[model samples]
Target chain A: MQLDVSHISIQYQDNVVVDDVSFQLAPASLAAIVGPNGAGKSSLLKGILGIHPLKKGNVYFNGQTLSSVRPHIAYVPQRESVDWDFPATVLDVVLMGRYPHLNWWKRYRSIDFNIARKSLEQVNLIDLADRQIAQLSGGQQQRVFLARALAQEASIYFMDEPFAGVDAATEKNIVSVLKELQAGGKSIMVVHHDLQTIRSYFSSILLLNKKVIAFGPTDEVFTPERIQQTYQRESLLL
Target chain B: MVESLWADANARTVIVCTLLLNSAAALIGCFTYLQKKSLTGDAVSHSILPGIAIAFLFSGVKDLWVILPGAFLTGGLSLLSIEYILRHSKLKQDTAIALVLSVFFAVGVVLLSYIQHHGNGNQSGLDSFLLGKAAALLSADIPLYFSVAFVVVFSVLLFYRPFMLISFDRSFALSIGIAAHRWQQVMVVLSVLAIVIGIQAVGVVLMSAMLITPAVAARYWSHRLPVVLLLAVLFNMIASVMGIIISYKYPSMPTGPWIVVCISSIAVLSFFIGNAKGILRRSSLTVQK
Candidate 1:
């Protein structure tokens, strides 16, 4: 699938958070959106997904408006945004991924449950299916969310800060999952903050600072000068 | 003693009414508790008093159909005011809740008094709405309670998945095209109806207690939404039955207060002795560690 974000601008109360940002990604690509604090990276992703209202712009998936192909797009929100103590099991959260496919009054079929189980196995959390969500570790929680996105069976995945507070093992697991998803021909865009791991983990980088500063392959765009320009500082990149 | 209470026709009617009322309340209460809107329950219930009083002032009778719509109007207005104050003013949600609660309750008190002094003798039972008189509930009122209970439970079942999704993660629910705003509006109407339905048996002063206590007690025992909902309804029925028995045996006691007292005691017990999440369990687990 081809994902295109055209001239997207997001504003809040007269303040422009993301301004005229545009990018495109082909299938089987892992792109990292790297930015400094307050760079509106998360807002830009949400705007593209139509979760956050866009001041102006259009998001096209496979050359059609995103709404026209809603089921093909999946989102993994920031872990901090979720209520940890919510009364749901791991399977319950993953099963919610199938809600869009089910009819209003329809209950989940055996096929849906099988898919959820497979997604959990992909994330290596099949053993914890019945555990309460709050009982999971931070990394486990992130994996659970990843499993939910996997169960969505989407071609394009948008993840917001999936590695915010995860441990090293969880991070490694997530990267491996991303590689597997890429191998399966899915396009994944992640809002990443870690500067140290960007080159090794992502095939493409969209360096942003409230705008599209640089967007291309990692080797071509992840230069020291562009990093300095994006963060608006010299010492941090040093 | 239990058999005697069950054998009396009037006592049986009160028991049946309370059982239905509490079950409806507990069903709606689970979602409000999950959303952390228990205080909103209290605010809306208190706000309904003036609506009931005004309805009586206009209709010159305390008819169930007439008063319920009036209560919904005032309850809805109170919720709107709370939202408006939270948005436009610097006050926090709790402060907004408190401000709306006291003002509306005061207005309700004034209206109740005005009716008592000025209105015709039909207004005699208006004061009973403050602290409900379960004894005064006639056998004819059973079907009304039954229908209210049916609607509350049926709507909850009909919208279970959407309601659960929205209450836990609203933005995610909205992202998936779940029509969160409509579900939220439906929730408010259902909650208001729960309060209105209980007014005769568990008056305005104590209605919110019924809405929160059962759910709070249930939370200590379960970590799944469905289980919590079922437990809440079960606890609510138990409390209502116990309250009915107590109030009947002691002819001077009111049903609403006893119902609240029973549920609060249940909540207190659950807080201390509940499985998994209870205080005792935590303390013991730490000691074992």
Candidate 2:
């Protein structure tokens, strides 16, 4: 349940994007990674998850390296990263969550289908299981990704901007799901926008601008002065 | 007319060869289309010309076996060069594909002209590769076609799930430890194989049409991967039969172009009338609203 990222750096053509970042997540904590545009918020998450190459760093979960604990980790990337017109149904996408558990040449069993169905139901998308993904609205598309992540049944989840461009109902559904996951003792980290909802939605906050600015409980770390330092702006909306 | 055409051995060879080649091309073409790299087939087909000329010069013969290996080498090199340019430079993918395609094709054209001027009488048929000569296929070439097609079809079936996963969401596949790079390489290899085998029947110019047209047509009809793939194969096979029959009747018509024409016709028809996302369906729905 323990997740630690130590001394992570990522570079794109000699310009460091994520510079020597480090952080730790408490068990069952829901954390938000808050940063401005070009703050390397996405890069840090991608680097730790091995999607992007790390210039230098190590990621461990419960004293095990990322590769060893890969099956227990689930990642829901940004909605814009994939083509929605790809030919697949909602259930077909959710079933992709079970791929890590199956070896090559092993077909999905009945249990995998059941889990996928349940995941779709959890997102209230069971009726749309057979629907083509291209027919979904933006919020429904985001929920499909969430359901896919939930189907993984992972101990830890990393989501990149689940609320970006989503409707209010989807935003509420996602927050409730995050709370439910926390209640079930699963650690979650989201690369979040919308500075207004940080305190209410997340238990811990990691203020990031390429490197870790602050990491602690929401109440202690979410101060106005710290937010100003993290964003490097002199505004007052909080 | 049908009985008489099927009764001829040469006609039978042409029919079987086109069926196998187009089926294999269309099968793998579904994935390439989904990956948004359909032009990779075009690049590979055009780039392999230099290899064919080089093999002809070295072997001093136009044997299918010798020329195919050479075509494969250059085809693979072109794909690697495209990958290299994309990785090292900031050039976009289309630019890289265009750059590699024209450069390699120029070299091939130069080598081909060199052989035409200096090489002996055996080099006369080499120019046929520009548009293809399905009528020139000997029975001995049938086995080679079958084996290549078998490998392509079998490999696709074996790695169907991984291919679908990577084509759909590469980052998600990598997150799940699916070796996305390795599967990408596998796709590269499959595309090369399909292009190399098809160039002789469909020619360098029209080979990409064989690879992409049926898949595009199939997409208009289905919203499922398996169904799309099946429909692509079926459409390709139907077009192949029609092409063979038309060429058989006319005798002056080239088999390769006719096959391309038939498949393209199907694709254009699908654009207007297909069931899933055709112009007719969308327009009708709009009118209903």
Candidate 3:
């Protein structure tokens, strides 16, 4: 599926948070959205997914609006975005991924549970399927969210800061999952902060500063000049 | 005394009515607690007072059916006004709640005082709504309580999944095509309905306690939503029965305040001795480690 975003702008009251940003991604690619704080990286991602109302823009997945392809789109929000103390087992959270497939009259089927369990296995949390979400460590909680997205079986994935507060081992696990998704012909977009691992982890980069500063393949767009321009800094070492 | 209490028709009616009201309150309280809008109940309960007074002044009678609609309208309006203030001003949610609560409640007090001074003799027992007179609940009021409880319980069963999803993660629920805003409205309406039905039995002042105390106690016992809801209902029902017995044995005691007292005592006990998250259990685990 082709992901297209055109002329998206988001404003909060008087402040223009994201301005006329446009980008497109080919199918089966791992892309990172990198920017300085307050650059609207997260806001842009949410606007495209229709989670945040855009001041002006349109997002298309495979030549269709988001509502038409919502079932095939998955989102992994920031780990800090949810109340971790909620009363839910790990498996229960993962099963929520299958909710889109079921209607009001339908309950979770055997296949849904199987898929949820398999997703948990993929993230190495199968052992803690019945454990409460509040008991999980920071890395485990991030993995729980990743496992939920996997259970969604979506063709395209949008993740916001999945690697923010995790250990190195968990980071390695997430990168492998991203590569696995790409290998399976799925598109993955992430809000990433680390500049050092950008080349190794992503095939493309969208350098942003309230606008599209540069967006292209990592080899071409991940230049020091573009990084400096995006962050508006001087004499930075990478 | 227990056997005679069961044998009396009025006592039976009060017991059944309190049970239904408390059960419904406990069920919806779990969602409010999860949404972190526990105080919404308090605000709505207090805000409904003016509505009741207005309904009585216009209708010239204190019929539960006539006053309930007015109560619901104002209760719903109170929530909307809170939302409006939050959207339009720089005030925070707690401030909005407190503002709406006090203003509406004051209007209600003024209206009630006016009716007492100038209105006809039909407004005699209207002040019972302030502190609640559960024993005064006639058998005629049973059908209304039954219908409201039916609506509350049935709506919960029907929208269980969507309600849980929205309470836990609203954005994710919307992403999955859950119509999160509509479900949120449903939650708000249900909360208003629950408060409206409960104000007569529990009174506006103590109604929020009926909603929140059981839910808070239940949270310490389980780490799953279904279990938490069940435990809350159980705790509420137990307290209701205990309160009824105590009030029955002492004829002068009011049922609503005693019910609140019983639930609060249970909550304190649960705080210390509940299964997993209680203080005693955690301390013991640390000692073992």
DockQ of each: 0.45, 0.53, 0.52
Candidate lDDT scores, in order, read 0.88, 0.89, 0.88
Can you tell me the CAPRI class of model 2?
medium
Cα lDDT tens digits, model 1, A144-172, are 89998888899989899999999898899
For candidate 2, write residues A124-203 as lDDT tens digits. 78998998898888899999999999989999999999999998988999999999999999999999999999989999
User: DockQ of candidate 3?
Assistant: 0.52
lDDT computed for candidate 3: 0.88
Ranked candidates (lDDT, high to low): 2, 3, 1
B1-289 per-residue lDDT for model 1 (tens digits): 8799888877877787788788889999999988999999999999999999999999998878788889989989999999999988889999999999999999999999999889788987778788887877756667877898789989988989998988987767766777788999999899999999898888999999998999899988888888889989999898888777787778778788988998999999999988856788766432100
Error of 3 at B54 (Å): 0.8
TM-score for the first chain of model 3? 0.97
Winner by lDDT between candidate 2 and candidate 1: 2
For the record, the alpha-carbon RMSD of candidate 3 to the native fold, in angstroms, is 2.3
Candidate 1 regions with alpha-carbon error over 4 angstroms: A233-238, B138-141, B283-289
Model 1 global lDDT (CA atoms, 0 to 1):
0.88
**What number of clashing residue pairs does each candidate have, in the order they appear?**
0, 0, 0
True contacts kept of 2: 0.58
